[model samples]
Structure formats: structure tokens, C-alpha cells
Target: MKTIKKLSLLSLMSLSGLGLAQYTPQWTEAPQQIDLVDMTSFKSISQPVNSEQQAVRFHYSLLGSDQLSDNNQGYLAESKQYWLNTNAQKLSQGLQLPVTSDLAVIRINPLNPTKSSQSLNQQDITVQQFDQTLSVDVFADSEQLKATGMPVSDYTVAFNVHTQPGMLTLSMPTATKALAKGDTFIIHVFEPNSEYVLQLKTSQQQYAANQVVKINSQLLSQSGVNHMTIAGYITQPNGEKLTDLSFQQNKNGDYQATIGQLTGQSLAHGLWEVHTIASSDINGLKVMRDVSTAFALSLPTARINQQLAVQSHGLKLGLDVAAAGRYEVSAVLSGINAQGEKQPIAMLMSAAQLNKGQADLTLDLPQDLIRQSGFKGPFVVDHISLKNQSLMVPVQQLSAGIQLMPLGKPMDQDDLR
Candidate 1:
């Protein structure tokens, strides 16, 4: 009887309505967020006079993955980096240290970039575990700092806080000072490449494998931006740069780029790194902001309704996929208690009609289903599955600093009858 029960349990978790994972309802995607560490006045500590270590704290957010995986994956990990330097090197290079780990390649890995022959003040450092917050212990000789004219001269030390592979939570070029004294002096804080905060947005988080994805950019801080251009390449899981992509400001200062196989370009389904280079003219002073965000390229792309009100016969929606086949809409509720195998319950499926690769979809989500499943919070209209294709939306809400990675597949049959 015990063996039979175990078999039943495994079989129950294998349910795949609309080609979704058995644990679709068990997952939730939150909009990624970031916290920038202000190194300008964050802290000032003299290098330990006798090689004593001082710890500095860094706080952050949005390092967790939204998709469901059987493996226990997390954003935090051990890092041997977290530099405190005066060379004024770029933080983006620090971003690549985890993958490259080439101290020689980074160039700034040396204790002193000025090629000073003194090892006394050549910073001794220890990197610890990274979470939403982290601490680094830096040891510097006071005499060595004074020898280098530090606190009296106001030399700035920088840190590159790597949150994840492509996502950076906080990076302050001059976030802290290893040596600080009561006397005020020349504070050597290098200006950031670009003071403008640019955010990349898409119509939806997920897309079809061969879909022509739309790119939307917003200058959160629009000051000092006379003109700007966006340039970069997308890196595939295979360590390949898909192509050199770029975009410039239009007549209305609108900048955009369309990339995919549909436009004589190549974009496949997998995790991708989008490295962006923005050169903007601030008061005629051209500055550059080089950063990157990540998302997944998928198949059966569609538009998701973020703020939908409950209707009598479910909510009507639209999709940006080929409008040729019958589509099935599915959903999973959020903020509810998991009781038995019924928590992530699949609602009654609804059929969708299409016109020219567009969907006027209304999934049959009745009040009975909501009450039965104990769905107290919002519902994630997760994905759309059809006879020939399916699309997965990794996130339900579009918030600031969020990175999207949606997935899709072709050849689908109803997992739930």
C-alpha cells in the first residue's frame, strides 16, 4: 500500500495542462529591483595601521529567479572580488570577473594601478558571501595611505557589486574610502560615465523562438540628455554573440531596435545577455553608460494583460502570435495556501479566436474555480498553449528594474481533458 501511495503521489504531480510544468502553480515571478550603494559619503576608514581589517556593508534587491526548477538555485554566492581601489577602473569589467576570473586580464586586479613599488598600502582584502546585503573587510596601512597622500588628498576607492551574471544590484565607482581623516581635502571621486538612468522594457516578458521582439527604452532621469544612441549585442547560452545591434534617436527622440531571424537576424530560445551601450550628450558633454540586462527568447509570443478586472465570463485578451489555430488559456493563482494537490489547480480552459496572428482570448475562469482553489491574491495568466505551439510568460507584473525570461514550445496537446 505504501508503494502504491508513492506512485500515486508522483503521478499526481505530473499533471501538465497546456504543456506547463507540474509545479506551475507553485511558482510566482516578481519584478526585479535594485539598490545602488552610494559611495560618495558611504564610509571613510583609514587602512588598518597594523593590517587590521575593516568591514563595509552593501545592501541590494532582486536577485531571485522567478521560474520553477527542481534544482535549488539562488542568486547569492561566494566572491573573491569586491575591490577597493584608486585606479578608477570601470565597474563593467568587474562585472565580468566571475566568468573570466583573470586578474591579469582585468588589469586593475593589481593592488596599485599607478605601478607604485610599495606593497605597504597595496590593499589586502577578503570577499565574503553576497546576499541582498554584503560586507567586505579591507585592510590598509595608515602610514602607507599617508605615504600615498590619501585622507589629506581625498583619494576615492571604488567597488563593483556583482548581483548576478548580467544583472548588477549596486556598483559605486567610488563607494568608500579606505583612509579618511578629520581634515577636508581634494575628494577624488570620478564622475559616473552617464548620470542618466535608462531602463529597457519589452511588450511582454516572454517571446517565441522566432518572434520579432519589440524594445522599449525609458530615460528615468531625462536630465542632460541632448541625444543618445543604444548599441550592444545579445549573448546566447552557447557563449555566442548573436549580432552587433544598435539604435539611434528618431525625430521625436525615440530610439528602438528590432532583432530576430524574422528581420534577417538570429534569435533562439535560451537565456540571453543584452549588453547595452548608451552615449548621450549632456549639455554638449557626451557621456556613456554601459550596462546589460537579461531575458529569455522563446516561441509563441503574446501580450499579457497586467491589470485586468474580474468579469462574468473571464477576461478577454490578445496575443501577438500567428493567428491561425485554436489557443487554450491557462492561469495560476497567487498568495494562497497550498492544501494538498489542489492549490495550483488549473482553471477551466477557454478557447480563443484569432485574426491575423492576433488573439481575442477569454479564458473561462469562474467564481467557483476561484473559491475552490482558495485563490486569495492575484492570478498569473501564465501561458497560452495551442495544438501546434505554446507561449510561457515568466512574469505577470511589469515593474521597474525587472528582467524578463519567457519560454515557449511547439507541438502541444491538451494535458488536461
Candidate 2:
């Protein structure tokens, strides 16, 4: 009676396609650490964008002495600019001038329907500095003045002045010919004394939770004295200041700071920014420079252990998750070929709802897939990884290969069709 019951169970398993051999994987060495910096970080859910509105296209470029010239063919390409038409262009906008005594040139080019880059001589455009009339110069054959898809050569104008620290209001009044709908206005500023520059840099553009972040900064000052004061602070995605960064000057003349290990759950997941400001008295002139840079942060919700085994179902992997979430495990299977070199045979993966702490994640390795490859064991598992599907974050990864002893009939040509 017992013999009959055992036979019945085995037959049931065979019918369900669950009858397979199980074996433990042998490890030749310890697993190596995975580099998350090489992978793309997951992006948060984006907000819905409203339909495009009929408005003027506006852009502004703030350039320094390094970019200004009498006739610049690549002025449009070389200058760093910002697009400000979030909804529509306004008739009047406030323009903040950088603090400098440099020979500054501010150009306001208004776009129109027919000619994308209309010369100031063709349009009655007005610019004011502190509500006063500002003198301007017009250039008729500036070839690089055209907007995208426009003719290569177009006419434009710029207002040049030896400026002190102040603000200017740029006015593009709406009229029959001066300004039109769906036009583009570009404001370019050139400062001759822009040789003084402050820079900020981070160690990496992305980091995992609980990882230490390093920062280095430097200032190329034309000032005679090193009397400048520089400081910076970090802000969360919400624009709230997280903490002030204290930078210490090193022997290499570089300002450096390190953010202690980020505590999981203490820091928010999103884009974080680092802002720096430097002020100095260069040649008795008060000069100030400020800049900001951003980086992406993510949580390490789970990790994969060195333990690997082959069971009746498939290859089993051990996972240690910090949070309860759906986790995925994948590995590359390689077997020894006739040349005594290990060659890739198959790629396997599996995913399941994993609870916090230790969990067994199995990847299905079909017998037929391996049999057809004609590779012998012991097999090797490489490029293994664990990821949290709920958060869309990579938990861990390993490139070091995991060795496994041969199971029943590691390779059989008879099994091949």
C-alpha cells in the first residue's frame, strides 16, 4: 500500500512538471561587491504636462569675456543659456546683472514669424537700464544670429556698456511690427572681467543610501589677494536646506568636504542639490559668484548573499532584504566547453514577493536549454543581481562568478532533440 502511494505522488509531480533534481552549489571564492554607479537610477513618477500654449519663445544667455567678440559666429552655440518660457513670454521681465566692472554687452533679439532672427535695425525694440534709455548697436550680417531651422545668416544687435553692479529691465513691447505671437527673444550678456570663476564638483552623480558622498571645489580668481570667503549648503528635492557644507582648503588649493554616511530613511529619495557662493575683493571691486549642481539618490532595499543552490525546481539564491518588496534575482550560467574554457550557456531570472530579511529566490534553469548548449559542468554563475521592484531601485549586484558542482547528468547529448 505504501509503495503504491509513493508511486502515485511521483506520478502526480511528473504530470505537474515539478519533478527535478536538487543540488547545493559549491563556492570557489567569496562574492565581490557590485558597482551601482554603472547602472541607471530609477526616476520618480513624472507630473503631467499641460498642452502647449501659443506664446513667445524666450531664452537668455549669460556669457563672460571668454565668449564675447566683435563678430562671433558661434555666439549662439558657445554661450550657456536658459529657456524661460514655462507658460508664455511676458511683455516685460526683470534682468539681474552680475557684479563686475567688465565691458558688458547685453543683446536682446526678438523673434518674429517671417524672419526668426530679425535685426534690431528692422524692429523698434527698446532696452532700458534702471528705467533709463540704454544705447545699443546693430549688426546686420551676423550669420549665427538665426534661430534653429532659420537661415544661416541673420541680422541682430547688442547693447554694450562698461557696467557697474546693477540690474536692467528688458522690454519687448507688443505692437503691430515690434513683437508678434509665437516669436523668440534671446538676451545675451557678455562681461569682460569674468575671468574670476567659482566651481563645484561632486564625487559621483548618483549614490546609494548609507553611502558617503564626497565633494571638491575650487575658485580661479584673478584677484591679487586670497581674501575671498567661500561656503556652500545642500538642499533636498523640496528646496529645503538639509545642511551646511564646511569646506577645508587642502595643500593642493582645493576646497573639499565629505557628507557622513547617509542614514537610510533619514534622507529622501530624489534629486538633491549643492549650492555654493564665493565673494572676494578683486582690485578693490566687490565680486560675488554663486553656482549649484544636482545628484540622484536611491535606497539599497535588498542584497544578495553568496549562497547558491540547485533544487528540484531550479537554481536557488539567498536574498537579504531590508524592506518588504517584490525582489528579482538573475544570473548568467556558464559551463566548461571542449577547449577547457568556460562559455556562456544560458541566462536565468526569477522574481517574487519577498519579505524582509532572508529569503530564497529561485531562477528557473530549464534542462533542455542546458542540454542543447553541449557544455559540461561544474557550471559558473556570473553577473548576479537583486533588485527591488516596488521602489525600482537596484539593491545589489555581483560580477564575480559563482561555481556549482555538476548535478545529475550535467550534460547529456541524448537529451537533445
Which model scores highest in lDDT? Answer: 2
Estimate, for each residue in 1-417, the C-alpha lDDT of model 2 and write its tens digit: 898767776665453353234344765667644332311232332211122222221112211112112210111111111222210145334444444543565555454324533524523545555567665554333544454343432444554554455555545444334433465655555555566566677776555565677777666656422445778898876577889998888777767778965522212254577877666665666555666777655556666667777776577777666556666666666777777866666666777776677887777665565566566667666666665555554565554566766456533323321
Assess each prediction's global lDDT (C-alpha) against the native. 0.35, 0.55
Q: TM-score for candidate 2, please give it.
A: 0.46
Backbone clashes under 3 angstroms, per model: 7, 0
Residue 241, model 2: lDDT of 88
After superposing candidate 1, which stretches have Cα over 4 Å from the reference?
1-195, 218-225, 262-270, 299-330, 333-382, 385-417
- Show the lowest summed lDDT stretch of 10 residues, model 2: 71-80
The TM-score of candidate 1 is 0.34
All candidates' TM-scores?
A: 0.34, 0.46
